[model samples]
Target: MTQDKLIRRVLKPVVWVLCLGPLGGLAWLAYSGGLTANPIEFLNRYLGEWALKFVIFALAITPLRGLTGWAGLTRFRRLLGLFAFFYVVLHLSSYVGLDQYFDWNAIWLDITKRTYITVGMVAAVILLALAVTSTKGMIKRIGGKNWNRLHKLVYLAAAAGCLHFFMMRKGVQLEPLMYGGAVLLLLGYRLVGYLKKRRRKSRLAVA
Candidate 1:
């Protein structure tokens, strides 16, 4: 089979299983009395982490594909991005349902007044937009050029997610720092590629 077919048929299914395994594990943990003392916080924080992880994974696709010369990797990007959005929704639900018990006024206060929550909400909103327009129908409706432009918002969403995670911490922690650094590296890679493309375009114009 061709590489692209292999990626689509074999690797994509494997990736799907791995990506969703965490949610299944969480359910098992909850059922088995393994969610620790603060189950709500555990689930909220855990789901948020997985969502950020998928975001980073989606962002890493370009650099990884460039380095490995595997164009087929791009096919998996939409799936990864959608999973990120899925987890974000779950994270929000956990926070509202379990943590706040659907307290709209308090939730509004937290979203508006709390720095970490506010930034996290901003990131969630950006992800929601990307998720809503992730379909082929939406792409056709928006036009490919416009869709590409709108999807670039993922970079800002990632940055905001990192900042939210960092600010949510009680003190200095290495985990958030590492996530921030990874995001910076991915963004730096994109910047370098953009500059190279611009330079190539300029050289072609001169020629």
Candidate 2:
């Protein structure tokens, strides 16, 4: 099959299933009494990790496509980004719906008092903006330049998310450090690209 057809017909569907698989497993665990004493905590952490993972994955797509010469990979970015948003929303839901039991007052206090929650909320809000504006209509309405400017916040959001995760954990966790490293790598790639582009422009202007 053609690359376009493969991306659209096969890869996309497979990715969709893989993305949803976590939630499905979580549900099954809860139903089967597999989650430990604190199911809410498990759900919250699991969903948040997956959300952050997808966000980082989305961030990595550009560099991957450029390196691998797979421009068609761009088609999957929106879906991946939206999945990041999906899992983030569910993460928040698990916190508020299951843990907080819809306690708005408590939730507000926690968000205000807890540094991790504050950062997590900020990241979530940023993801929400990105997700809402992911559509073609929204992109056109906002215009490409402004839309791109707004979407640049994804890096900040992902960085904040890594910080949030690290802060949430107690101490000496390799996982958060690895995530931080990954984010730096992806952002570093962009930085390199930007510098190269600027250099090229400078040479052209000089000529």
Candidate 1's TM-score reads 0.95
List residue ranges in candidate 2 displaced over 4 A. 31-33
Candidate closest to the true structure, highest TM-score: 1
Which lDDT tens digits does candidate 2 get at residues 1-207?
988888889999999999899879888998999889987898889999999999998999999999999788889899999999999999998999999999999999999999999999999999999999999999999999999999999999999999999999998799999999999999999999999999999999999
Which candidate tops lDDT?
Answer: 1
RMSD of each: 1.4, 1.5
**Per-residue alpha-carbon lDDT of candidate 1 for residues 47-104, written as tens digits (9 for 90 to 100):** 9999999999999999999999978889999999999999999999999999999999
Judge candidate 1 against the unseen true structure and give its global Cα lDDT, from 0 to 1: 0.96
TM-score, every prediction: 0.95, 0.94
Cα lDDT for residue 32, candidate 2: 94
Kindly give the stretch of ten consecutive residues in candidate 1 with the minimal lDDT sum.
1-10
Q: Count the backbone clashes (under 3 Å) in each candidate.
A: 0, 0
